[model samples]
Target: MPAPRLVPDLVPDLVLDLALTVRHDGKGGIADDLDGVDGLARWVAARGDELAEAGAPLGDFVADEDALTAVRALRQAVRTLFARAVRPAPPSPADAQRLLPGAEALDRLAAAAARVPVAPRLTWPESAAPEITYVPTASGPPADLLLAALARAATLFLASDDRTRLRACHAPRCVRYFLKEHPRQEWCKPSCGNRARVARHHDRHRVESAL
Candidate 1:
């Protein structure tokens, strides 16, 4: 089989993407894309445009040890809340035991979102429709700003109707949370569905042999 594709851009929610940084490694183990400072920098760069749109522009952002630690903390909180949102469903097994309490996660997200001041600004091009975008008002540490924007995104997603569509991918070894784009959507992707079917087939085969 081809490698399990862990695409960060698979979802529109920045918070969901951040949580998905932890995923299946295709070897019966979990992988963390932000395992180190370098990995954190790469992750930030990959989401530069989206971050900028969300009012936390970190152009050419460089990740230091502190940045990596802070971002990872925020990610932990986000994942905790994500697990809560998909209640009655199993969360990704990667940090299943390490999730923060629901109340604590809410506090963390609120605090992180307040790290930088932001205000909604409206703009319109000559031939385009008017739109509003949140823009940071003051300067702060790159990590702090990024965390604020990401937390805000999480806040909005959790409070919006879209939260109902979020589901944890329970396919074997798939440590991912995905937005249920359609009614029939089960796993995070088609590949995960294939893996799940194969695993079920093997289980049935074993049961038949036992009989």
Candidate 2:
């Protein structure tokens, strides 16, 4: 059988998309899509237009070790926030504090969040009439812009009612997180759902044989 492609679906929100970067395989192994500087670059490139629409473009990405490190740290922080928020209990003050460790980080995120423009404006496509579009106004190194975009996404996600629907895939070898668009949706994708069902079937057979 062919391997399944890990295509990025157009998630309802950016924060949920970011959380999908690091996934746990149902079999106890973990995979980080943004593993290093190159990985980070690729991830950004893949989402270039999306980020641009959100007012953060990757045209100035540094692709250095330091930049990669910063991005990874921020990714982990965002993941931490999501993990805690989705728990049955409400997130505590300490939980929120962990996301914004120091004054500097907090300021950076705040600044980035502030950079998002108020509204999308009209733009004319070649040979077409003007259409409303979000032109990126945020400026800085790519990493900074990326972080700011992430910060903004995190803020919006945590503040919205839809945050309650954020869920991590329950399949044993799957590590993806997804927004539960429908009440019955369980896994990140159909493959994960099939894998989970197969595992359950095997377990049931094993128990029956033992009995």
Question: Could you say which candidate leads in TM-score?
Answer: 1
Off by over 4 Å in 1: 1-11, 123-131
lDDT against the true structure, each candidate: 0.82, 0.64
What is the alpha-carbon lDDT of model 1 when measured against the actual structure?
0.82
lDDT of 1 by residue, 1-211 (tens): 2221112232246877898899888898989999999999889888888887777879746799988888888889989988888988878788778899888998988999899988877776799766555678899988888888888888777776667899999888899998999999999999999999999999999999999
TM-score of each: 0.88, 0.70
User: After best superposition, candidate 1 residue 21: deviation in angstroms?
Assistant: 0.7
lDDT by residue (1-211, candidate 2, tens digit) is 3221111222245766676777664457666777888887788888888777666767777678877776676665666666666687333222344455445444554665564443456666798755543444645666666776677666555555666887767675665666788989977789889988999999999999999
How many backbone clashes can be found in candidate 2? 6
Worst 10 residues of 2 by lDDT: 2-11
RMSD of each: 6.5, 8.3
Q: Which parts of model 2 are misplaced by more than 4 Å?
A: 1-12, 24-28, 89-138
**How does candidate 2 score on lDDT?**
0.64
In terms of TM-score, how similar is model 1 to the real structure? 0.88
